[model samples]
Target: MKIQYFIPAMIYSLAFALQASANHPGSNLDDVMSEKETFFQAINEPDAPSFELINAQGELKKLADYEDKIVVLNFIFSNCAGVCPLHSARIADIQEKINSTPMKRLVQFISITTDPGNDVGSTLEEYGQTHGLDPINWEFLTKKADDPEDFTRKLAMEYGVKFQPEEAGQQMHGVVTFIIDRGSRFAAKFHGLKFKPINLILYVNGLSHQEKKQKQSFLVRWWEVIYYYFIH
Candidate 1:
């Protein structure tokens, strides 16, 4: 994949301050902020929560099955007029770019609906079709009958987004696009619609070339080292 390399101002601004304080401690803020860093915020590397969900065809799907491929996950409801449409469009743009490259098969896209009641069968399929999301690697999903009414929304909460039903039948919620690394199981999140679509593509492109590392945190690294020498 061809990468468009440009640092976002806000992300670079915050990243410089944080990395400088954490790494150099006494470095000048201006100098620290000038240092280049990738903005895919490394978290505690939480295990991405997976649950039972159904696609537009009402077939059961599980997140764990995609362990061999990179997963780009988002939350949206078909009936939403606010951010969901724009969010879907942005994802569509990213998909078009990805499909042109070899990264296409390495990635999968999922958007779980907040309005499963309205988005079913053809309705769910049309949302993806309208957005030009390729069905081979993308799915617009909803909860099956056995799952709780709010099961999918509750799962979205695990990814750090909250949703509540508005009086007009729309939901008040935040937009987050998540990238889950294959096998390594650590998930990184890109928050909000303001982030560039190319930035996300660049990130996944990086992950595709990444040699899978087992533990990310310093503590976890040391613990594993000690176990290998002593316990093993």
Candidate 2:
């Protein structure tokens, strides 16, 4: 199994699991969230865009690093005196709620800086701290040492948002919190600052349980096949 093929394979397996579960379910969690959360937008896209950004400690981080955990991802620059701060605080609130429960271990919170040049060193670390983002399950990432100035900003665009830099050290962009399921499946987005924090939390909780349900469903099917062929 080459690394490149691994994600697609996981996506296929996940799709099978979801379809299998759909047959027995009362209502799909994705659908439930869509109805309950006015701002929740369900997406069935492929793997999210790849990135090779660096954290505050200068270690290289990629999308694959958190493949085992449901990723709560967003993009922001540290210097933004506008909606960026509010957006980050919203994420922090969501992180806090999730961390209080067992879901904390199953989720990963990622904040990528669109302006990596200024968001280096303590800047990255401080932004998280200032916004009450817990380090236990959250990370603020920036461009790597040799990355181009607009590297992360470009990556943001790949995710369907733009962070256009302005002369006053601000970037114009919308607030969207992305949810990537385990295995890098681009799952959903919680748009804007007005979404209920608990809605995002419940959605993440649903995603975490979905993986477990999928594995259980797979085992059940395997056993049925064995019984039909070898025992029955």
Candidate 3:
């Protein structure tokens, strides 16, 4: 009958209620958003294609390094005069919006270069600045010395985009912004620059909320088990 004894019961009830709401039909936010947003394509690949690349600081980085954060990923080279720049600029815009809110800490922005040969050293460090991408939660990645020249290009293809090199230092490719949810689930993609930035931000917010609810449900169940043993 004590107030403290009722705390666990309240939490358990609330957790179950949330779980029920989450399990209700049409409750999948990713699928709902994909249908509502014209350019957003929702996917359910269990594991995103992995990659090990180098950051601008010459340090090694991998897809797993961002395990707990939502990833906004794209591919670009420093020298392109075409859609690469446009795609990066669009990402920069999205990053700015996300950073303005508390969600900044929960998201990471990644740009992998298809032209590692030219996008080395200062080129890697300066590309973000030139394109308005902040270095706070963003990285411009390139292949390492031991990697093949087309290493990142192949990885990009795995993500469903191709960076086919062409004459005059240009590469032919479509622009796509991939959204990888926490735990490396390939959640969705925003194709082309036509998609509204707000739509992507909202989708990411939905994913973040979904993850929070899952964690809360787990903690509630854990607390209930501990309380049951303590009462006896």
Which segments of model 3 are wrong by more than 4 Å?
1-27, 211-232
- Local distance difference test, each candidate: 0.67, 0.76, 0.77
Q: Candidate 2, residues 1-232: lDDT per residue as tens digits?
A: 7743553343334334442211112236667667667899988666878888889999989999998888999999989988999998889978876676656677899999999879998999988889999999999999988889999889998888898888889888988999998778888888888887756765665565433555545534543453344334
Off by over 4 Å in 2: 1-27, 211-232
Per residue, candidate 1 scores C-alpha lDDT tens digits across 1-232 of 1223222322233222222111111112112112212334443264678777898777898888787788898999988878898999989988877776666777899899877778889998899888878898999889998777788789889888888888887899998888777753655677788665655664565455422233113223433343344334
Order the candidate numbers by lDDT, best to worst: 3, 2, 1
Question: What lDDT would candidate 2 get against the real structure?
Answer: 0.76
The TM-scores of all predictions, comma-separated, are 0.73, 0.79, 0.79
**Candidate 3 lDDT (Cα, 0 to 1):** 0.77
Ten contiguous residues minimizing lDDT sum, candidate 3: 18-27
Could you report the Cα RMSD, in angstroms, for every candidate shown?
A: 12.1, 12.2, 11.8
Q: Write the per-residue lDDT of candidate 3 for residues 146-198, one digit (tens) a residue.
A: 99999999999999998888999899998999999778888889999988775
